[model samples]
Target: MDTFVWRDDYSVGYTPIDEQHQELFKRINAFGNALWEGQGKELLAAHLRFLADYVVSHFQTEEGLMTTHKFPLYEVHKPVHDAFVQEVSSVLNRIADAGLDTATAILVFEKSCDWTRAHVRGMDQELGRFLGAQRNSTAA
Candidate 1:
Protein backbone atom coordinates (compact mmCIF):
# COMPACT_ATOMS: atom_id res chain seq x y z
CA MET A 1 0.00 0.00 0.00
CA ASP A 2 1.19 3.51 -0.77
CA THR A 3 0.75 4.95 2.70
CA PHE A 4 -1.36 8.01 3.22
CA VAL A 5 0.91 11.03 3.13
CA TRP A 6 -0.26 14.27 4.58
CA ARG A 7 0.46 17.12 2.24
CA ASP A 8 0.15 20.81 2.99
CA ASP A 9 -2.49 20.78 0.31
CA TYR A 10 -4.54 18.51 2.53
CA SER A 11 -5.02 21.17 5.14
CA VAL A 12 -8.57 22.41 5.39
CA GLY A 13 -7.43 25.73 6.87
CA TYR A 14 -9.23 24.66 10.03
CA THR A 15 -7.04 23.48 12.82
CA PRO A 16 -9.36 20.86 14.29
CA ILE A 17 -10.34 19.36 10.96
CA ASP A 18 -6.76 19.30 9.69
CA GLU A 19 -5.56 17.72 12.90
CA GLN A 20 -8.19 15.01 12.71
CA HIS A 21 -7.32 14.39 9.08
CA GLN A 22 -3.68 13.93 10.00
CA GLU A 23 -4.62 11.61 12.83
CA LEU A 24 -6.59 9.48 10.39
CA PHE A 25 -3.51 9.13 8.20
CA LYS A 26 -1.35 8.32 11.18
CA ARG A 27 -3.70 5.53 12.24
CA ILE A 28 -3.80 4.16 8.71
CA ASN A 29 0.00 4.11 8.59
CA ALA A 30 0.19 2.34 11.92
CA PHE A 31 -2.24 -0.28 10.67
CA GLY A 32 -0.23 -0.66 7.50
CA ASN A 33 2.89 -1.24 9.55
CA ALA A 34 1.08 -4.01 11.41
CA LEU A 35 0.15 -5.57 8.08
CA TRP A 36 3.76 -5.33 7.00
CA GLU A 37 4.69 -7.32 10.08
CA GLY A 38 2.17 -10.03 9.12
CA GLN A 39 -0.25 -9.24 11.91
CA GLY A 40 -3.02 -8.15 9.60
CA LYS A 41 -5.58 -10.86 10.30
CA GLU A 42 -5.30 -10.84 14.04
CA LEU A 43 -5.63 -7.08 14.15
CA LEU A 44 -7.95 -6.36 11.23
CA ALA A 45 -11.25 -6.36 13.04
CA ALA A 46 -10.02 -4.21 15.90
CA HIS A 47 -8.43 -1.80 13.49
CA LEU A 48 -11.57 -1.49 11.42
CA ARG A 49 -13.69 -0.93 14.50
CA PHE A 50 -11.31 1.68 15.79
CA LEU A 51 -11.25 3.39 12.42
CA ALA A 52 -15.01 3.34 12.15
CA ASP A 53 -15.37 4.83 15.62
CA TYR A 54 -12.72 7.45 15.00
CA VAL A 55 -14.33 8.43 11.73
CA VAL A 56 -17.64 8.93 13.47
CA SER A 57 -15.96 11.17 15.99
CA HIS A 58 -14.34 13.19 13.25
CA PHE A 59 -17.61 13.43 11.36
CA GLN A 60 -19.34 14.72 14.45
CA THR A 61 -16.75 17.44 14.75
CA GLU A 62 -17.32 18.50 11.18
CA GLU A 63 -21.08 18.35 11.52
CA GLY A 64 -20.95 20.45 14.65
CA LEU A 65 -18.83 23.05 12.97
CA MET A 66 -21.13 23.18 9.99
CA THR A 67 -24.21 23.56 12.12
CA THR A 68 -22.59 26.17 14.28
CA HIS A 69 -21.45 28.16 11.28
CA LYS A 70 -24.67 27.57 9.37
CA PHE A 71 -22.82 26.10 6.39
CA PRO A 72 -25.08 25.78 3.39
CA LEU A 73 -23.72 22.43 2.35
CA TYR A 74 -24.33 20.54 5.57
CA GLU A 75 -27.32 18.77 4.12
CA VAL A 76 -25.37 17.52 1.13
CA HIS A 77 -22.17 16.82 3.07
CA LYS A 78 -23.59 14.85 6.00
CA PRO A 79 -25.21 12.19 3.88
CA VAL A 80 -21.82 11.46 2.37
CA HIS A 81 -20.47 10.82 5.82
CA ASP A 82 -23.44 8.60 6.55
CA ALA A 83 -22.74 6.59 3.43
CA PHE A 84 -19.12 6.06 4.43
CA VAL A 85 -20.19 4.94 7.85
CA GLN A 86 -22.51 2.43 6.27
CA GLU A 87 -19.75 1.23 3.97
CA VAL A 88 -17.44 0.69 6.90
CA SER A 89 -20.18 -1.15 8.72
CA SER A 90 -20.67 -3.40 5.72
CA VAL A 91 -16.96 -4.15 5.49
CA LEU A 92 -16.81 -4.94 9.15
CA ASN A 93 -19.62 -7.44 8.71
CA ARG A 94 -17.94 -8.97 5.66
CA ILE A 95 -14.71 -9.39 7.52
CA ALA A 96 -16.53 -11.00 10.38
CA ASP A 97 -18.27 -13.42 8.06
CA ALA A 98 -15.45 -14.40 5.70
CA GLY A 99 -12.36 -13.96 7.86
CA LEU A 100 -10.28 -11.52 5.83
CA ASP A 101 -6.79 -12.09 4.50
CA THR A 102 -3.87 -9.69 4.28
CA ALA A 103 -4.84 -8.72 0.76
CA THR A 104 -8.37 -7.75 1.74
CA ALA A 105 -7.08 -5.83 4.72
CA ILE A 106 -4.81 -3.88 2.43
CA LEU A 107 -7.72 -3.12 0.12
CA VAL A 108 -9.65 -1.68 3.05
CA PHE A 109 -6.75 0.55 3.88
CA GLU A 110 -6.33 1.67 0.30
CA LYS A 111 -9.99 2.45 -0.21
CA SER A 112 -10.15 4.47 2.99
CA CYS A 113 -7.00 6.37 2.16
CA ASP A 114 -8.25 7.11 -1.33
CA TRP A 115 -11.63 8.26 -0.02
CA THR A 116 -10.08 10.60 2.53
CA ARG A 117 -7.72 12.19 0.04
CA ALA A 118 -10.54 12.83 -2.38
CA HIS A 119 -12.94 14.07 0.28
CA VAL A 120 -10.38 16.42 1.74
CA ARG A 121 -9.36 17.71 -1.66
CA GLY A 122 -12.94 18.24 -2.67
CA MET A 123 -15.70 19.17 -0.21
CA ASP A 124 -13.46 19.74 2.79
CA GLN A 125 -11.49 22.35 0.87
CA GLU A 126 -14.67 24.16 0.10
CA LEU A 127 -15.57 23.92 3.79
CA GLY A 128 -12.20 25.30 4.73
CA ARG A 129 -12.67 28.29 2.47
CA PHE A 130 -16.10 28.92 3.89
CA LEU A 131 -14.93 28.67 7.49
CA GLY A 132 -11.90 30.85 6.80
CA ALA A 133 -14.09 33.50 5.30
CA GLN A 134 -16.38 33.29 8.27
CA ARG A 135 -13.47 33.69 10.64
CA ASN A 136 -12.13 36.62 8.72
CA SER A 137 -15.48 38.35 8.59
CA THR A 138 -16.00 37.89 12.31
CA ALA A 139 -12.54 39.24 13.06
CA ALA A 140 -13.08 42.21 10.78
Candidate 2:
Protein backbone atom coordinates (compact mmCIF):
# COMPACT_ATOMS: atom_id res chain seq x y z
CA MET A 1 0.00 0.00 0.00
CA ASP A 2 1.20 3.47 -0.80
CA THR A 3 1.78 5.84 2.08
CA PHE A 4 -0.98 8.38 2.47
CA VAL A 5 0.49 11.72 1.53
CA TRP A 6 -0.85 15.16 2.40
CA ARG A 7 -1.21 17.36 -0.62
CA ASP A 8 -1.43 21.13 -0.76
CA ASP A 9 -5.04 21.00 -1.87
CA TYR A 10 -6.03 19.37 1.41
CA SER A 11 -5.32 22.55 3.31
CA VAL A 12 -8.46 23.83 4.99
CA GLY A 13 -6.99 27.35 5.28
CA TYR A 14 -6.82 26.95 9.02
CA THR A 15 -3.46 26.30 10.61
CA PRO A 16 -4.68 24.16 13.47
CA ILE A 17 -6.88 21.99 11.32
CA ASP A 18 -4.22 21.65 8.65
CA GLU A 19 -1.61 20.64 11.22
CA GLN A 20 -3.96 18.07 12.69
CA HIS A 21 -4.66 16.66 9.25
CA GLN A 22 -0.96 16.29 8.64
CA GLU A 23 -0.64 14.37 11.88
CA LEU A 24 -3.46 12.11 10.76
CA PHE A 25 -1.69 11.48 7.49
CA LYS A 26 1.45 10.58 9.40
CA ARG A 27 -0.41 8.13 11.63
CA ILE A 28 -2.14 6.49 8.69
CA ASN A 29 1.13 6.22 6.84
CA ALA A 30 2.80 4.67 9.84
CA PHE A 31 0.05 2.12 10.14
CA GLY A 32 0.32 1.33 6.46
CA ASN A 33 4.05 0.82 6.73
CA ALA A 34 3.63 -1.48 9.71
CA LEU A 35 0.99 -3.46 7.91
CA TRP A 36 3.04 -3.90 4.75
CA GLU A 37 6.04 -5.08 6.75
CA GLY A 38 3.97 -7.82 8.42
CA GLN A 39 4.14 -6.22 11.87
CA GLY A 40 0.60 -5.02 11.71
CA LYS A 41 -0.93 -7.91 13.55
CA GLU A 42 0.86 -7.01 16.71
CA LEU A 43 0.40 -3.26 16.48
CA LEU A 44 -2.77 -2.81 14.50
CA ALA A 45 -5.10 -2.74 17.44
CA ALA A 46 -2.97 -0.28 19.37
CA HIS A 47 -2.54 1.87 16.29
CA LEU A 48 -6.26 1.84 15.66
CA ARG A 49 -7.04 2.71 19.25
CA PHE A 50 -4.73 5.70 19.08
CA LEU A 51 -6.10 6.75 15.74
CA ALA A 52 -9.67 6.56 16.95
CA ASP A 53 -8.91 8.66 20.01
CA TYR A 54 -7.06 11.23 17.98
CA VAL A 55 -9.90 11.45 15.48
CA VAL A 56 -12.42 12.12 18.19
CA SER A 57 -10.23 14.83 19.66
CA HIS A 58 -9.72 16.41 16.27
CA PHE A 59 -13.43 16.35 15.52
CA GLN A 60 -14.18 17.98 18.85
CA THR A 61 -11.68 20.69 18.08
CA GLU A 62 -13.32 21.40 14.76
CA GLU A 63 -16.80 21.41 16.27
CA GLY A 64 -15.74 23.72 19.05
CA LEU A 65 -14.24 26.12 16.57
CA MET A 66 -17.38 26.09 14.44
CA THR A 67 -19.60 26.69 17.42
CA THR A 68 -17.42 29.48 18.73
CA HIS A 69 -17.43 31.23 15.36
CA LYS A 70 -21.15 30.63 14.94
CA PHE A 71 -20.70 28.87 11.67
CA PRO A 72 -24.09 28.86 9.96
CA LEU A 73 -24.00 25.20 9.01
CA TYR A 74 -22.63 23.89 12.29
CA GLU A 75 -25.73 21.85 12.94
CA VAL A 76 -25.48 20.15 9.61
CA HIS A 77 -21.75 19.66 9.86
CA LYS A 78 -21.80 18.15 13.32
CA PRO A 79 -23.74 15.09 12.27
CA VAL A 80 -21.02 14.16 9.84
CA HIS A 81 -18.60 14.05 12.71
CA ASP A 82 -21.02 12.00 14.75
CA ALA A 83 -21.47 9.54 11.94
CA PHE A 84 -17.74 9.20 11.45
CA VAL A 85 -17.22 8.55 15.15
CA GLN A 86 -19.87 5.85 15.10
CA GLU A 87 -18.28 4.28 12.05
CA VAL A 88 -14.82 4.24 13.63
CA SER A 89 -16.23 2.94 16.89
CA SER A 90 -17.79 0.06 15.04
CA VAL A 91 -14.46 -0.77 13.47
CA LEU A 92 -12.86 -0.70 16.89
CA ASN A 93 -15.54 -3.04 18.13
CA ARG A 94 -14.78 -5.44 15.30
CA ILE A 95 -11.12 -5.42 16.15
CA ALA A 96 -11.93 -6.15 19.75
CA ASP A 97 -14.08 -9.06 18.67
CA ALA A 98 -12.01 -10.70 15.96
CA GLY A 99 -8.48 -9.49 16.66
CA LEU A 100 -6.12 -7.84 14.17
CA ASP A 101 -6.34 -9.34 10.71
CA THR A 102 -4.59 -8.06 7.65
CA ALA A 103 -7.85 -7.80 5.78
CA THR A 104 -9.34 -5.56 8.42
CA ALA A 105 -6.29 -3.33 8.52
CA ILE A 106 -6.29 -2.86 4.77
CA LEU A 107 -10.02 -2.31 4.56
CA VAL A 108 -10.09 0.13 7.44
CA PHE A 109 -7.33 2.29 5.99
CA GLU A 110 -8.95 2.46 2.57
CA LYS A 111 -12.33 3.44 3.90
CA SER A 112 -11.29 5.74 6.75
CA CYS A 113 -8.52 7.55 4.92
CA ASP A 114 -10.60 7.97 1.79
CA TRP A 115 -13.47 9.44 3.77
CA THR A 116 -11.04 11.79 5.53
CA ARG A 117 -9.54 12.95 2.24
CA ALA A 118 -12.93 13.67 0.75
CA HIS A 119 -14.02 15.40 3.94
CA VAL A 120 -11.12 17.84 3.84
CA ARG A 121 -11.98 18.78 0.28
CA GLY A 122 -15.70 18.93 0.86
CA MET A 123 -17.21 20.07 4.15
CA ASP A 124 -13.95 21.18 5.78
CA GLN A 125 -12.95 23.40 2.92
CA GLU A 126 -16.30 25.10 3.13
CA LEU A 127 -15.84 25.59 6.83
CA GLY A 128 -12.40 26.97 6.14
CA ARG A 129 -13.79 29.48 3.70
CA PHE A 130 -16.29 30.69 6.24
CA LEU A 131 -13.79 30.93 9.07
CA GLY A 132 -11.20 32.58 6.90
CA ALA A 133 -13.72 35.16 5.77
CA GLN A 134 -14.77 35.71 9.34
CA ARG A 135 -11.19 36.37 10.40
CA ASN A 136 -10.50 38.64 7.49
CA SER A 137 -13.66 40.61 8.03
CA THR A 138 -12.91 41.15 11.69
CA ALA A 139 -9.35 42.13 10.97
CA ALA A 140 -10.41 44.96 8.67
- Highest TM-score among the candidates is held by which one? 2
> What are the C-alpha RMSDs, in order, of all predicted structures?
1.7, 1.4
Candidate 2 lDDT, 100-138, residue by residue in tens: 799889998888789999999999999999999999999
Which clashing pairs does model 2 show? Answer: none
* Per-residue lDDT over 1-140 for candidate 1, one digit per residue giving the tens place of the 0 to 100 score: 53678999999998989999988888777777777778756586677677778899999999999999999999999999999999988888888855558898888878988999999999998999999999999999
* Per-residue error (Å), model 1, residue 26: 0.8
Clash pairs (backbone) in predicted model 1 = none
Each model's number of backbone clashes? 0, 0
Off by over 4 Å in 2: none
